[model samples]
Target: MAGVEETEQVKGATREDTQAADREPETLYGISGSPGIVVGRAVVLRPRSDDLVRYRLEKEAIQAEQERFQEAVDQAEQELKDLRSKFEGDLSDTLTIMDSHIRMLRDRMILDQTANLIEQKQINAEWALSRALYLVKKKFDHIADEYIRDRFADVEYVVNLLQEQLSEHGQQFPTGFAEPVIVVSEDFTPADTVRMQSEKVLGFLTEKGGTTSHTAIVARSLGLPAVVGVENITERCRTGDMIILDGYDGRVCLSPTMDQQKLYQEYDRQHRAFSEELSWYIHLASETLDGLRVRLSANIEIPNEIEGVTYYGADGIGLFRSEFGYFQQKHLPDEETLFSVYQDLVIALDPQPVTIRTLDVGGDKLAIQLPGNKFKALHERNPALGLRSIRLSLREKTLFVTQLRALLRASAFGRLRILLPLISLLSELKQVQEIIGQVMMDLTDEGVPFDPDIEIGIMVEVPSAVTMADVLAAEVDFFSIGTNDLIQYSLAIDRGNEYVAKMYDPLHPAVLRMISRTVEAGHAQGIEVALCGEMAGDVFMAPVLLGLGLDELSMRPSAIPHVKRLLRHSTSRRLTDLAKQILKCGDGMETRALLDCYLASNAGEWRERS
Candidate 1:
């Protein structure tokens, strides 16, 4: 709060005018890694690249250089082990991450390769390590999974540690700050983030990271406001510069004016007040005023998020993206590894159904190892419409069967359901069932314990699936509408493409029809219907989804309270009528107008009652 420096008053100019003229505000946008808002002075952390220098070594010095590299590796391992020791219990996920780093340090791909490079190339220890990192990064780049490719950051983190040790940089991070500050850095590792103290660090602004990166995961766990993937953020910001971080909108404002600061202060106050109000609804049941009950579940990517799910009062986990385990490590996860992860999740939330969606990676996104341990990338003109999801699973039966075995084995622990992604044909469903049956028989022959009556479901995303929903519904136990892809595929628009992004609207009549028809088809076959997508989490779309006869809504943990509060205040009959009116509209504009009018009329009543 006291970071903004005031300029001396000039002749005929006010202090505010002088300060405003001296400092110009600049804004940078990036991906929202966590949620919160903070205003503080920036504390920039220098990148490790600054300490890296490549120099040729004499042939006789190669052996000593290799020994130096080995020493650095040893030091890095000891540092990680010491850090791991600090976290002893209940923080199993954090410990697992540390263990992964430790294993990576000793891996032949990194350890052996760097040592070999130092001797073969006759280069300094720092240069050999950097080259080894570059080669390993090339392999990571070949990985089709974005989440898996991001793990390269973890490798970089290890290398950074070794680099620091090799350079003899005493300590890269500051032990303490004079006042609370926003940390701006080229990137942060889980190690760096774990070492941070919330009392001294107000937020984080980084140049590299994704929503699923380890750094982002740690930031969320720490309840820090972070905006990552901003280009040149470290270069743009300097120490002690006044800054405001808006994690909700992925924005960073540097050198803010008085008006901007005041406005953001007011916004922060309102957000805090609204959060306090929502806390009151966390323990309430998700049901309409007329007593039409619906399940509110959370969609999580990793096991560490289980704490947030329970804290947010979710009835269960609606959608667990299971592919993270597949790419969390260097090699494909074995059945036992998968089972361990799945079992932990099931046992933690016993009696509450946890719906785990199978691996949804393939098409242009698939990076598989060919014979001789070579990585190959699959080429596809249109990955979304190409060989992905169910198709890939069927083609790779060995992979598919392995996952089924893990899922079934974990079922014995607690409530678990298997949700398949992108099932467009009845044949795909049948093939999956056949494989499941064979796997179950094999498990029985092996005398492995598992649940015999495990429920199976499919994601209704493509238009073909919507058209054949009634037929597919008869085969599965439940239906989860993936509106994100449904809307995109139905409108022939790629939401990620800037050219047609504005055309991707969930309120479009065709999108609503697809959802309505899928719900009807599922209900006709006596199966429950749930919506798990971006639409389900939106408070504005809660009434519409409820009116469409969905039995459950799964969303991010943070959105559960607001959506539940909206649903609890409205009656089913009113929402159904509103849905019917909107469906009759001819276009997206008309539908949105009608929905907005309804929400406007009832918004105040809902708030006042709350």
Candidate 2:
């Protein structure tokens, strides 16, 4: 209402046309960083570009310039330490990110390289620091994994801190908004996001960042509505401009009319009420009207997400992506660091099992400092199909062994499952089992404590793996279908490619058949089969997955409650029947329509009951 103006007269216009013409809001779209909706004033945080001056220093001034760089590094390190201390009891994910930032600040790549460049190139500290950041960016640019590659944002944050320290123009967090406001910036660092007071900050809009960036991670952890990767949001938005941030659809609307404002307000109210209602199912068992029980678990990447798992009443962690710790550091993490992280995760969920996925990234993504320089970075044309996941582990035995040792050690704390990724052949599973055996043997010889009979599993992702699921199922303890990759590889459609992205469908007949085959194979072996994919999080797909006889559904934390409620309200027998009909569909479109109809009919029944 504050930003709205009176409607203007239009000749021969209907009431709807007059209402629509009251205000024509400009909308911007981006990647959803988190899920929610809010309307607030825009607070644009423009970057300070004037401080980053690039100029050569005289020979006599080089010593001072090098010293200045070190001073800046020391200050940046101290600032990160202070920030880390501030969030000591806060989210563990925030602290982990802070620790990574502190490590980056002191890493030789930033600290030594910047100082070295100042002395060698005889340039100002700002210029030399920028050069070091350029080198770091160049290295990260070649990383094939988008999640790992997005970590460049962390490095950029560290560099920006050093730059600010050198120029003595440190940016302050925008404050003193009378009302909650949406913060728009070129990009947000994890520190900036973590430091934001949720009561004052309605959401976030950024010009640069992906969902995997640390900034986005913090935002999601905070339960804030955020839309990242919006081009020129800071440039276009001005302070006090009314903004509508829709995290669900990744949309931002500027200067909404009275009607538009009322619509979104109702949407926000319903969303809040629905979220509150979902909490009622948290304490209830994830079972259908029939007596069939299903394990509703969470797929988490960081330890702090442990909070979400417990809050959402998940059975346990279904897929713990173990690659984040490895990619966050300047060098490969040793067994001790790896064990500490894993041990914390296991200890936190003592009775509840934590399934840890082994390093699933490709060799091309491991550009970090490897011991002895033995592991050379492969420049594969298509890294996804190249030496990655299980293949990379086998080739780099030592790397794989170290991780296995750490995981085995952590298993001593609580229920732990080791998941190997991309096992296309029986031989791959056999080789990994052999290495795991050797690690167990060594630990035995050393009189180290471990779970000797720890369960092992494989991510049935590749098409070959699906074909050989029965063979692999016999060897492994369980099967976790990685439908994200399964759909991509099965359809030969690169989900990242705009041209073929629409073709990459989880509801495709082949994909559902593949899931059915994997479930059947796992059932034949008498092992649990779980789906830990984007599809698993989808409420509509929950019935289909249940019908396919999946023992578990592992997805993001926020999605757990919705899926749980769906599971509890519906009958498994009905879901199974629906799945049977859907599997008969010819294509994804038809499958979707049938699923939609089923959901609509069910919703109508639910409405009548209410």
Candidate 3:
């Protein structure tokens, strides 16, 4: 909370005039949610809760309260739509993020629960909103996937906006800024990021968020510097305090010295330039020095993300997360809706093959959406290892059939592949194949046009799948190794849990061995192997994966150029030798040491241009 001391004395100010500047400077650290750098005056914005009054509503007034809630939701949706429309051309990424928030605003689960509570409890709209939010948070709290759990932030932000509107306080940002200022808040949703873009906000500092948070993702897309989870930034500095937001390192330096400001300014300049330089690799091939070509693809979440894939010159969409449709919609998307979305994506990619994974949700994700009154509580003590993915689909035949039927119908439009998620045992894969055959037979009998030769693949995430990779590879057309879940299951460490995140290592000898085994087995069967996981995007691990003979690598679109750039400068012979040595190592630290040594020796070539 201390302020930085001025290195130079002011021309006319006395010692009393510089009392605030005399305090020692403090540097707060957090996760680098978005990468860039900026120095600006800090504007601490806190949500207004003063006008939130709680009073019981009479039975006759319940209808009015419900209508009031609807009005507030509508107002919030309009504000979001207007804000999203401002960024059209180069900021399409931001638009997609805003779409998610808009969907959250219209979620039937939230609206119905809030309205029901208002009618049954005879409480104020605010009270009912709080109760509904509590229900959503309760479900998220039990989620095993950390990324999915972060979605709860969207619910909180949407409810907050609705409450602000209903209270008639609306919302306000600090005004009269003489210059661009860094906006600091307890949290910033995607909507907040959009709002900041309309103002003179240079960057942002948040007390709570993660790298995968929608706010952070939008910040990166906009090239805005942002650091989140900095703990008590609002209390540390007042509005207009000079601050340096080091988004690359996730450091917030309050009241920086004159010298520090200049150094950061230069760093910021180089960072922007480096980012531009990486864009040059967008149209280049991902080929090693030995002339081996590796397929680089994009792991997309939404249909809109296809634009990014084309811009980045990705070979195709390696992983289309179909579950996102379920998450974004109020109820389940019908077969027609699903088919249309898939059709669009495949048509956009055209010649490049699109691999679509089926609906992969269980426990925390799907159970939360089921009506509490209709369905019994769907509980799982450990959702990650419980009935999920292929297992869940097998149990719920109709849900699985609808998705398969839609996928089959869409296959006629473009090159398509079906990917099964979280497949552990051979039996699970076989069960899925049986269902796929039945669907194909039904379509055949009905004279519906569909692609019968659509390549079927399985996601090798669970350890059992890795152990039985040879047999599983024979059962499927290909294998896509999901290293994130594999690492978690292999090491028995939940990366989502902060306490044990340190133990979650993808470079663990066991994990690498599983990858190597899977790739070899798939290749032995003349089937291609791809990796669609966090590790695939990580340039530092690119050499190892390539050397392990991965046929394809799929990642977020933004990461494609960096990974391709790294591959272009690398030699397969050198990488293969290093990987061989790494495989001989006993532990992850040893393997990491080998990798670091290689990178250090070849820094001149491996490092990206500025």
Candidate of highest lDDT: 1
State which candidate, 1 or 3, has the greater TM-score: 3
Mind giving the per-residue lDDT tens digits that candidate 3 earns over 149-170?
7777878878877877777545
Per-residue CA lDDT of model 1 for 1-610, tens digit only, reads: 0111111111112123322346679998998998888987777776534546788889988888888888888888998888778766745666777788898898767888988888888888888888998987765554544466677888888887887788754455554465677878888778777777423788889999888788887788777889999999877876667889998889999989778989898888888898899999999999999999999999998897898899899989999988766655667788998999999999998999999999887542453422114334555556667778888788878888899999999999999999999999899899999999999999999999999999999999999999999999999999999897888889998765668889989989999999999999999999999999989899888888888889999998878998999998999999999989888989999987887998999989998887
Q: Assess candidate 3 and give its lDDT.
A: 0.82
Mind giving the per-residue lDDT tens digits that candidate 2 earns over 1-610? 0111111211111233333333457888999998899987666777764646778888999888788788888887897788778778877877878888887887777888988998898888888888998987876666545677787788889888777677644665654455566778888788888767533788989989887888888888778889999988876776656789999878888878768878988888888888888888887899987878999999998787888899889989999998876755667889999999999999999898899999977744553423234555565677777888888889888889999999999999999999998899898788888889889999999999999889999999999988888888899899999998888889988766778777778899999999999999999999999999999999988888988899999998878888988887788889999989998999999998998998988996655543
Against the true structure, candidate 2 has what lDDT?
0.82
Off by over 4 Å in 1: 1-21, 25-28, 46-64, 87-96, 107-109, 112-125, 131-150, 230-232, 257-263, 369-387, 494-504, 585-591
lDDT of 3 at 96: 77
- Candidate 2's C-alpha runs over 4 A off are 1-23, 49-52, 142-144, 168-170, 198-200, 363-372, 607-610
- By lDDT: ranked, best first: 1, 2, 3
Instruction: Report lDDT (CA) for all predictions.
Output: 0.82, 0.82, 0.82
Comparing 1 and 2 on lDDT, the stronger one:
1
Estimated TM-score for each candidate: 0.86, 0.90, 0.92
